[model samples]
Target chain A: MSTTLNPGERPTGYLPEGADINRNIAARRLRGKIWQALFFSSLVIGLLALGTLLYTIIDDSFGYIAVQTKIDPEELSDRPLAELSKEELIEILRANISAGLFRRFDRDEPFSERSKESVLQLIEERVIGREVVASFKLTESLLERERIEATVRERFPRARLEFHSWLNRDFLTRPMSSVPILAGVGNAILGSLWVIAITMILAVPIGILGGVYLEEYASDTWYYRLIETNINNLAGVPSIIYGILGLAVFVRALEPLTSGAAFGVTDSNGRTILSAGLTMALLVLPLMIINAREAIRAVPQSIRQASYGLGATKWQTVWHHVLPNALPGILTGTILSMSRAMGETAPLIVVGASTFVVFFPDSVFDKFTVIPIQIYNWTSQPGSQFRNIAAAAIIVLLVTLLLLNATAILLRNRFKRSY
Target chain B: MTVAELSAVDMAQANGRYAVELHNTHIYYGSFRAVKDVSLQIERQRITAFIGPSGCGKSTVLRAINRMNDLIPGSRLEGRILFHGKNIYDPDVDPVEVRRRIGMVFQKPNPFPKSIYDNIMFGPRINGWRGTKAQADELVERALRGAAIWDEVKDKLHQPGTALSGGQQQRLCIARALAVQPEVILMDEPCSALDPISTLKIEELMLELRRNYTIIIVTHNMQQASRVSDYTAFFLMDADRAGQLVEYGPTEQIFTSPNDKRTEDYISGRFG
Candidate 1:
């Protein structure tokens, strides 16, 4: 065949050898450089979005720990108010009331006529330092300190006012209240602990056994397939559905077992700690089952054959060999399930977890409120201070969930097999 | 040699020595025929090698000897597989007991997720081998020595068995199979996955073991059969998708002067 060339072609290497090859190589390099830049820019953009989200959450919640407050000494003198003749105590409270504190009073009640309100405000502010003192004894001690600080400040005008953040002892000890600074999460903490304990007790064994059965014993028949598909579907079901189920089955059907009969609460509709725990357990049961089944199924078949070849019975092979190998994965799954259960609010609320509980959960049969419910209550209130308290509660819950997940990760890493 | 001479030779070799006998045995996986009708006798105190190409059903037949096929979901066997003249697959026979008596070593080494000592003790403990701790220790040492792996692993008996080298792991598996004091041992390409050195060591261990126990090994390595086996059975796939035994005699006779053209072609390295 005769060779021909276009005018701009290499013309059978008329000028220099390998020129066309060099141009082709440069073009390929340029294309690859462009592709690399595009890929890296996409990755950077995705990570930036994630970083921005995390930054926003941290910024919003950090105000709970950062807000500074100055307690005025003149506002903290004890006035022997209850023991004083009513008229004299009212005169002392009126003299100390500030314009800022007085402006919040009801407009119809003249300042002098609102003696009860004015006296209560004096006791709350002067005796308690703008924060509710926990006990009668603590209130007396706070009043004495305020009197001493007032004397010291008058003697030394250059002394700076000692300011402190409001997230303190009162914030941790008192129960939820309309007054945000006076509220604490002691009851909610106890309620969360009880729910977690009960959920672990109810869910772990049943989930593990169900997983073992589905992975090891059951044949790959249509019935088993349907069950497996349903379990995966159930894991995605809304939390409210589980709450309704718990309300019907645990609260109503098993009312006698949970609530003592002495109250004659026969309706079985009252929310109790037991009912809330059972509801949360049901909410996370499908997730635990699916994860545990996947863990068990991931065990190598050669291990099973090796056990059987050693003359081990089926149960012995499973109990002695299989379960131990799959335990790390199972624990990881259970930890994730527990984290989901701890943050769930809808199911607990549906099961009648109270929005306002003054005392800790004294028994499983008693009414209770968890941390998420407390946060929800605070978020719905009409005060910025309550919002800060809600943000603090969210931080507490996130830290607790992080610790649990870290423990699961540690166990999973420690026992992970090379095979 | 002629068929008559081969029969005489087999008879002489079988005199006063028989560990397993298969009579008109066939194996199937659901509707797919794997091992066709075949008859053979494995002599005690000898290494009998089943040599064939891939998919020739050598491993299938070896699994049938100990009734290991029973573990497969849809695998079925016909005819008789007799161990010590007792039908292993009889209705009254327990497969577990048969496996305890006749141990197995798979192509890939599978050590339990346990200590080296525990891997060897598993078989004896399962069979209720009541003895002093020292006696169990002695059995483990003896089995390890028999498999030629005692010195390399003796210091780390408490370590996980899976931590051993590939060759050491295979030897550990052999030692585990030997710990049960089985009358017969089935090895299905035990050294196929090993390096040349490990393969030679295992072949030597098999030679040493034949002095006390019967060994039936399935191998794709023709050199291994010639080097380690006293008698070799050459199996080939038939038109019906079943594997048939084409020749069975002394290794030297089959490798040097086979009576069948297919056997001759296979021994000559022309085709599998």
Candidate 2:
């Protein structure tokens, strides 16, 4: 039955009565625009945060660069200053004003104008071949080598200098210095390397073996279930707890083997590299075990059955078929765990890692300080210069972490199998 | 009902030679029985098929023959399973050695995550078969050919076994089983996960395998039982919490002319 519609509700040609096509299109466009705006805004926020962080680090680090200076070889070797009486030494410094070695203040010049620390620094850099000054000519002409040498000689006559930057050979060879210019990370670098080596050696085998036992051998009874639950819970436990355990057990309980003052130190406190390493190992042990268990569990049960069906013993199946398939995943997990151990500081601190160590650890029992601890120490100081040192240390740390993560990712991608 | 009646009955009908003999076998999981008082004879160099509805003890009986059921926790078996005229469950018999002689292929194809060549060589290597590399290679080729998979996978033998299609993977598994030269092969629905073409290929492979190795297979497909097996055993769930064999005979007799009415109804698709 056909019915007549009211005049206000009449349908247009080739259109459904209730449809508003333009409005629907507009709504769809509005949703698309909103999504686009959200995506762009999120990206902008991320970039802005990154820029602010970088700006802050650079600004703080600039003060350290300003304070750092190279010691003039001639000044260090000056015998006249040592041999002369105090009155003669002061007169000699006054006579070398034209050489720009020292600035002499007269009654006419203001205190600010008479201060020559900055100018002396610039002149020393030029004399030492550290700063390059370009010579401009009307035509493109190379200055004669002799003339260029003479020009440099005329600029500074009293003192001989050498080219040096804030980052120099001494920065890599020397230990942390009270003088900012002489500070280096060589000791900390060695300490970190030793800690990581010992941590991996201690953690990997124990973690892997425990994982194999839990996943392959142990019955799924209440006892094994309890162990599994405890391992997962341990993974979430704070790193500082492991430190306390190491301090109490390895430091005090096993004192006979690890506590002797063989390194010419009298303190019986367990602040050795071995103690810190063992503490770090305990911190990441549960992480390694949990990841390894997951990797082993991911191996298909069918493969195990197939091996067993071939008359291969249970051990044979697990060793040959199951373990090989799970190796890549295990390696990935291990690398990630090692990365955590590498960067961990809280546990080492609790275990008494010295923050002011000056020498490389000669043995596992020697006191040590790692890069993070060194940076942490530097950051706690009152001067902004030390904060810059910490920032530089952080850059080194981030680069090291990046290299390790890249290697892990590369290994995982290289050996990844579909099965 | 009595020893005298059983002995009298045995004396009247003990003529045919059997490769495997299961006598009053009962299987249990913890306190629950899964197969009860099952007795059967598996003839030598023959393809035997066990067909039934889900959880009817077809696979359980098949696993019991090779002592594969021992792998399952809490599983226990009563009664005797005699292989080569000796009790397979004897305390002196090593399960590993027993399994070496009686290989198994599971319902799903499970090729090792290894090169196709390695998957076939794995069994021999583990069993301490010392031979020249050339000899091992030749054996791998022969085994693959025996399973009718050599032609398709010959050029790609170095590729990972898991890279093959499902059907090829199953054939590779069969070849791996054959590599160890088992006396009896147990297949638990070996072709259930395959397509029609692969299933027919597997059935043909079973028929060819019967000339050398005794094969026992469990299948849900009724047509497969009629197409390939020489002997057929029909199992049905009984009220005593375990499955019982309703009938066992030549394949033609079981399919076209079953003695038991239950077997006939199941074969005709009237009821399962």
Best by TM-score: 1
Candidate 1 has an lDDT of 0.79
Task: Write out the backbone clash pairs for model 1.
Answer: A75-A126, A76-A126
**DockQ metric, candidate 1:** 0.46
Best by DockQ: 2
- Cα TM-score of candidate 1: 0.80
lDDT of 2 by residue, A1-419 (tens): 24566667756666522557777778889999999999999999999998877665544433212111243435533663344444443344454345444433333453345334433433344333232222212111133445544554676443333222333456556688764544777788889989998899999999988888888888869988999999999999988888889889877776554555655556645677787778788888999899888999999888887888888888898899778888888899998998898898888888788888787778887888888998889889866456656766776676688888888899988877776
TM-score for candidate 2, please give it: 0.77
For candidate 1 chain B, which ten residues in a row score worst on lDDT? B1-10
> Cα lDDT for residue A258, model 2?
59
Worst 10 residues of 1 chain A by lDDT: A132-141
Instruction: List model 1 lDDT by residue over B68-144, tens digit each.
Output: 78878789999998766668888877777777778888889899888999999988887777999899899999989
Task: Please state the error at residue A245 of candidate 2 in Å.
Answer: 1.0
Model 1 segments beyond 4 Å from truth? A1-50, A64-72, A75-126, A129-174, A260-270, B1-16
Pairs with steric clashes in candidate 2:
none
